[model samples]
Target chain A: MSKDAFRARLEGTAAAIESLLDRLLSSSPMPGEIARPPRVLDAMRYAMLGGGKRLRPHLVVETARLFGREDEGVLRAAAAVECVHGYSLVHDDLPAMDDDELRRGKPTVHRAFDVATAILAGDGLLTLAFDMLADTPTDPDPAVRIALVLALSRASGLGGMVGGQMLDLEAEGRFAADGKPIAGSEEDTLRLQAMKTGAILAASVDMGAIIGRAEDSQRNALAAYGRALGQAFQVADDLLDAEGEADLVGKATGKDAARGKATLVSLYGVDGARSRLRRLVDEARDSLTAFGPAGDALARTAVFVAERQS
Target chain B: MSKDAFRARLEGTAAAIESLLDRLLSSSPMPGEIARPPRVLDAMRYAMLGGGKRLRPHLVVETARLFGREDEGVLRAAAAVECVHGYSLVHDDLPAMDDDELRRGKPTVHRAFDVATAILAGDGLLTLAFDMLADTPTDPDPAVRIALVLALSRASGLGGMVGGQMLDLEAEGRFAADGKPIAGSEEDTLRLQAMKTGAILAASVDMGAIIGRAEDSQRNALAAYGRALGQAFQVADDLLDAEGEADLVGKATGKDAARGKATLVSLYGVDGARSRLRRLVDEARDSLTAFGPAGDALARTAVFVAERQS
Candidate 1:
């Protein structure tokens, strides 16, 4: 697949995700709900729609397509992952967390809404993610729906994304006895990054496999692909922060180093980090050997992760 | 059933929930997880265990027992409800929310840990609630597990508890156009209380029915009981906050009025609120007509809600 074809596929999936999210976050309440407060609903819609690369959902769609499964259930699952991703961003941008004022070129949820509304919006999104997965529209099979919920909760829960965020805060010396920043070893950085960022990204691909009902070997292969791709994506993001222009990145840049955030880029020089990015991208593509030409788009995505300007 | 018997049963279920939560929030990482950061794990455990009445879990246990589910799975489901309740309290006590320094006779999670840790702790507990439900131990049948997840998420998500919190904030005039507190109508208070405090309480009973595989009529009856019981519980809670001593209630009293919180008590005055509480408790028990002797414990619980000193 050419770069343009991959970009078009990615953009198509992003648009679909946006539409699904809009419908999910609509003002009307679903069955079993009392009422949807308009203000919080608006904040949730603001946090989710019209933002980000939608990379996780793109991975879900592409990987499911790899296994010859493409349907509404796939889109629902993709939207669910995006909800978790969006919720994490909202919470991470709160006054207590990263305190980011701008996200995807718009004010962060807390900046757009109040702190309390932002908190509830993030909570709503996180809870709704599981709700969407467990709904029959996500999958006809109860087992499969339960599987998706289990996978998602594990990826986003204590030992995964949330834990990763806590570790990141601790590394910033938020909990240190002397109140000074703590520097982590390279191994610690790798583990933290995998939990914080890699777990959810990998789960997005694994969820597609679950929806596709892939064979164990196929699932494992795709998971390997996802792991490498996740790592490469993070290293690429760190690189963007280190070298890319703030206007192009759509958020403040170079703040990571200033906050003493432990990143692979800080441990490795730009040249070394770039080489590692290349190696991971190769590994990502190599794991797609089972899919042959069908894996071309995913292979290109790995390249996109490595070479994208933002 | 005697008051002592009901108290013993409640304590037994609470102990069981505490034990289950301890195991679930243990430091050892579960499958598919990289590592559970110690600080976050501690914060999660701190937030969940060693506090509160465990009223939600007691509701689950009794309601499940009212049918025929009396096993480990029932305990697991109950624990999941408690986790959601715990997470809500943790978030509600945040500096940006109610900013309460203490809860249940101890410092709030945000006070014990930093705001960032408290936020992540709440996030972790909330995610784990779904995880515990989705796990096979919660129910051997995947369909039952999915039902539990769907019901719990709806109760706690956008149009439920989270949405209720948002409405509560709005009612406090947090978003008032003229920068003044908004005085909500009686209807608004009723809806807000139902969503904020009543949804999850009702879910506790409804979840028990789901676990017990109650017939549609039986489930509906239990739901009615839950709805009335939840309203009664909240009214009693407000009464306690209005009149009980801080030492006995385990937190500051009368803060609701100070914050201009929209509660039934505010709309009805002390005597009227008490009368309404009695009426709700009667309604709760009236909904249990089908169970007769089997629902004796639940009937007693309603009286407890209305009459308990703390």
Candidate 2:
């Protein structure tokens, strides 16, 4: 697929996911509830809508499409994943966490709203994500719906994204229980990155595979593709932080080095990080070989990850 | 059952739940991982273990017992509910939220740990609750597990506890979007209390009923019972806050009135609140009439709720 074609596909999927999310966020999860808390709803919408490449949703859609299933089910599942993504970003940007003030070319949720509202907004989004997955529209089969919930819970839960965040916080010298610095080996950094970001992105693909009821072999291959792409995405992100213009990157650039955050880019330097990103993108593309051209959009996504400025 | 018998049963259940929770909190949710972030794990354990009334879990057990099923399934489900309760308290006590320094006789998670770790610890516990529900040991039937997941997500999500919490925060004059005081009518206070505390406690009973596969009539009865009991519990709690000593209550008292946080007790006055509490307890006991003597302990629980000093 051409880069333009992939961009168009990605854009369309993102638009669809955004519209669905807008409606989902606007309404109360409990139908009979009197009102949606306006402040939290606004914060949730501000964080979620009109932003980013929608790369995770794109992964969910393309992976499902490769399995010959592209419909409302995948769309709903994709939207749920994006909610989790948005919630993480909101929490990550909190004054207590990464202390990021900007995200996606706008003030972060905490900056846009008060810290209390930002926290509730993150909580609301996180809770609603599971609600969306379990609601009947996500799947006809209760078993399949349950599978999605389980997979998402594992991906987002402790030992996954949340645990990774805990490690990231420790690495920042925030709350080291034993009074020791956590910034250690490159392996530690890689492991932290995998948990913090890779888990959810990989789960985005894995969730689609589960929804599509992919065979074990197909599921494993897609999961591998997702994990590789996720790592590549992180490396590319770090590279952007190291070298890209601050305005083009949306948030502050060079903040990772400023915070002494251990990253692949920091350890390997720019040229080495770029090489690693290339190898990862290749691995991602190779994992999708069994699907032939059906995997074309996903392969292009890997390429885009390596090349995008932000 | 006599008051002594009920007290014994409640004590036994709390102890069992505590032991189960201690084990659950100590182990890494993901085994073989390099290391669980020690600080977050410690905060999670600290917040969850050695604490308050296991009233929610007891409700699960008693409600499930009404259907003649008493086993690991209810225990797991009950433990999951408690985890949600514990996590909510951790987040609620954050400096950005209620700003409570003490909870259950110790420093709140945010005070014991830092704000960032407290947030992550809450996040970790919330994620772990769903993970517990989804794990195979929670239920043998995938359909049953899915039902539990859906029920829990609804109970804890946007329209439920979190939404109630958002309302509670707004009432405190924190981030009311319209910049108006949210301390409104008694009806509004009841609604807020219902969403905040009542929802999850009610969910605890409903979850047990679902796991027990209670008949529709029984399920509705138990759910109604739970809702009434939850409201009664809240009123009783407010009474404690208004009238009890700090040392006995394990936290500061009279802060509710000082903060101008509307409550049923404040709306109706102490005597009126006590009368309403009696009526709710009666309603709770009446809902269990079909089970006769089998519900004696639950009936006793209602009495206990109204009469307990703490």
Candidate 3:
């Protein structure tokens, strides 16, 4: 696929997700807006509706399409997953965490709004994500909705994203004295990255498969594809941070090295990380062999993940 | 319904919920600990165990008992609601929010641990609450589990608790110029209080009703009871903050007045708030009239909510 075609596909996904989010989180007098406070909705919109690649939602859509099931339910599930992703970004940019002032080429939620509002907005978005999954509109079968909730909570909770965050913070030497690095091997760094970003990204595909009601074999294949894609995405992200310019990356660059945080690129040189990324992308594309021509879009997605500037 | 009998029942309920929470949040490999990490589990345990009246869980169990269903499922649902409540308190006490130094006669999570850990702990607990609701052990019927997830998310999300916190922070003049009190009516104050504490408390009963598969009329009646009990509990809490000693309350007192925060008790004086509290208790007891002797435990709970010192 050409760069222009991939960009068009990404923008279409982003537009769909942004509209769905606005419908769900808007403070206007919709069916559920009877009790929604305006200021909180404003803050939530700020965190959710603006701009990003919407890569997680794209994975959800494309994976569900693999099973030949595309409906409003899939779209809502995609939006739900994006909500969780957006909330994590909001919380991660807080002053006590990464302390980032900019995200996606704009002020972070905490910088645009007050700290308290930003915190509440993140909390609201996270809770709403689960709410969306359990909502009747998410799927006709209640069991599928329940399964989505269960899988997503596991992906985002103690053993996954949040727990990984705690490890990442500790690795940043915030708990250590005199900037002494914490002890961990190369495998540990990869595991940390997998847990923090890879889990949720992979879960997006898993959720799509669950909603589409794919067979176990197909589900396993998609899971493998998602895991490999997640690895490629995160490693590419680290490489961008390690080497990309601030203008292209849309946030501070080289801060990972400055903080002495552990990353795949940090443990291996940039060339080594780049090589691993290429191999992961190849693995991701190879996992969809069963789907043949239907998997071409996903294969293109892998290429986009590997080469994107931001 | 003697005081001694009620005390014994309350203690029994607390012990049961505490044990369940320990099992759920523990790092030990007792079934669901496949991917649980240790440090985040420690923070979650600290946030959840060893504090509060366990009023919410008690509400859940007793309400379910009123419908003649008492089992592990109810207990797990009870523990799940408590996790949501506990996580809210943890996040509410963060430095950017309440900035409190102590809670339940001990240091707050941020005070006990660091701010980043506290934030992650709160995030983990919230996710786990949804996870528990969707876990098969929580209910035999997947639809019931989905219903529980749906109801709990609505209670915890933007239209409910988190949005209320945003309003409460705004009422504290956190967003006002020079800390000037915002304009509002008495009804607005009560509505704010209802959204903050009342929603979750009522949600506990709603969850119980859903789990037990109550009749429509019974569910509505129990919902009314829960709402009234919530109001009574909050008014009593405000009165305690207004009049009780700090040591007796197990945390700070008179902070509401000091911060110029609006509350039912602050809007109306002590005597007025007490009268309202009595009326809400009567309303609650009256709502349970159809259940007759089966609701005796819940009736007694209303009395306790009205009269408890802490």
How much is the lDDT of residue A143 in candidate 3?
A: 94
Candidates 1 and 2 compared by lDDT, better number: 1
Q: What DockQ do you compute for every candidate structure?
A: 0.91, 0.59, 0.65
Q: What TM-score quantifies how close candidate 3 is to the native fold?
A: 0.97
Which lDDT tens digits does candidate 3 get at residues A16-73?
A: 8888888887665333322788887898998888778899999988888888877778
RMSD per candidate (Å) reads 1.2, 2.0, 1.6
Question: What's the candidate order when arranged by decreasing TM-score?
Answer: 1, 3, 2
**Colliding pairs, model 2:** none
Instruction: Report every candidate's CA lDDT.
Output: 0.91, 0.84, 0.87
- Point out the higher-scoring one by TM-score: 1 or 2: 1
Best candidate per TM-score, number?
A: 1
Candidate number with greatest lDDT = 1
Which CAPRI quality tier does the interface of model 2 achieve? medium
User: Interface RMSD of the predictions, in order shown?
Assistant: 0.5, 2.2, 2.3
Better of 2 and 3 by DockQ: 3
Q: Count residue pairs with overlapping backbones in model 1.
A: 0
lDDT of 3 at A276: 96
| Predicted candidate 1 versus true structure: per-residue lDDT over A140-259, tens digit per residue | 999999999998998999889999998888888877887666888999999989999999999999999999899999999999998999999999999999998988888899987888
